[model samples]
Target: LVKPIELWTGKQLFSVLLRPHANMRVYVNLTVREKNYSKSGETMCPNDGFVYFRNSELICGQLGKATLGNGNKDGLYSILLRDYNAYAAAACMNKLAKLSARWIGNHGFSIGIDDVQPGGRLNENKRARILEGYGKCDELIQSYNKGMLKLQPGCDAAPTLEAHISSFLNNTRETPAKVCMEELHWRNSPLTMSQCGSKGSPIN
Candidate 1:
């Protein structure tokens, strides 16, 4: 049975994998494909590449390239993780998470490490670095949220809307059900019922 482990940084998701000693030889197949989608939602040009990594003090991958049909370079790529130890594997995952948050941002896709968990044990320094990296990612998310809230009209008009909504709710709380229904119908629609209603319309 294959169990997939995932880690979420504020900006991107990383999947990690770990295996036993007998399957130590690790190969990461990196496939590059065109971002252009056909009418049927299929990729136009898909090319293959490979990277080899093994257990050691310094963990790294040896890059290998693949040829495209039109002799042009591949634009988008995916990383496939395979056969890795716990320590080296977790390190690889943390590195990918950091890179995705700092460099890739929202434009790039997520990376997956084949067989590792988010809470997997690692060296002290490595763990610290990963935590620090994710903390920065959280800050980015918070900044984005604040920017989006400022762009919202409801937030901009919150002071007036809050007063209107509070008054309407408080007045309606003890009103009879039949009277409330009659008032709702007389208003024709919720949008025209109160000044706050139109501005507070749900997006979806």
Candidate 2:
């Protein structure tokens, strides 16, 4: 007679014991595939398995099959806040970052990821939102007046406008429009809307 098995370890013992053989084999194979691919696609089968794994890794990092991970996720902002080159570093982030054709003046936004897009994610919609949110332009102007060093992480830091823009963009997701508007307003002209009023539309 078979000995009674002790199921004390809190493992899913019943499921393991009664698992169907054919489905069990398929599940095992899938697990093996996951393991093999995760470890740099080493044990992947010949023909397409290695290729598929390699391409998937290249595209998604660890974000499963969707490449960009569901929707406009926060991972890109995380990467940017870490002081990475947004364009080059986008590869490591969730793959949704994309550049737009409408240029942000000479700088040309080094915006989103994905090989398909080229201009770097700037557009009229983004621009409009940015413009609308940054109602108070004098604050940044004041910071510039009081020495940008105060805004830096430490006493010795001297961040450029570009660097400050990057940090602001990353952290200001709720006000992405405002942050962007600030970037545009701050970077271009000395006179803000407050300073110039109706005539002070900086883009003009």
What is the C-alpha lDDT profile of model 2 across 1-204, one tens digit per residue?
124864443123212322323343211111112111333544444211221222112211222222122332333233233444554334433323222122344355332333112122435545655664363234554666687534545423345544655555544444443333344433233223222232322232
Per-candidate Cα lDDT values, in order, are 0.33, 0.33
Q: After superposition, how far is residue 140 of candidate 1 from its true place, in Å?
A: 51
Query: Can you tell me which runs of candidate 2 are displaced by over 4 Å?
Result: 1-24, 29-125, 132-138, 155-157, 160-162, 171-204
Per-model TM-score versus the true fold? 0.18, 0.23
Candidate 1 residue pairs in clash (backbone atoms < 3 Å): 15-113, 16-113, 16-115, 16-116, 17-113, 17-114, 17-115, 17-116, 18-115
The RMSD of every model to the true structure, in order and in angstroms, is 25.0, 21.1
lDDT of 1 by residue, 81-166 (tens): 23334555456556655764875565543323421112222234345545655665455446555653233345543454445445
- Summing lDDT over every window of 10 consecutive residues in candidate 2, give the lowest-scoring window: 26-35
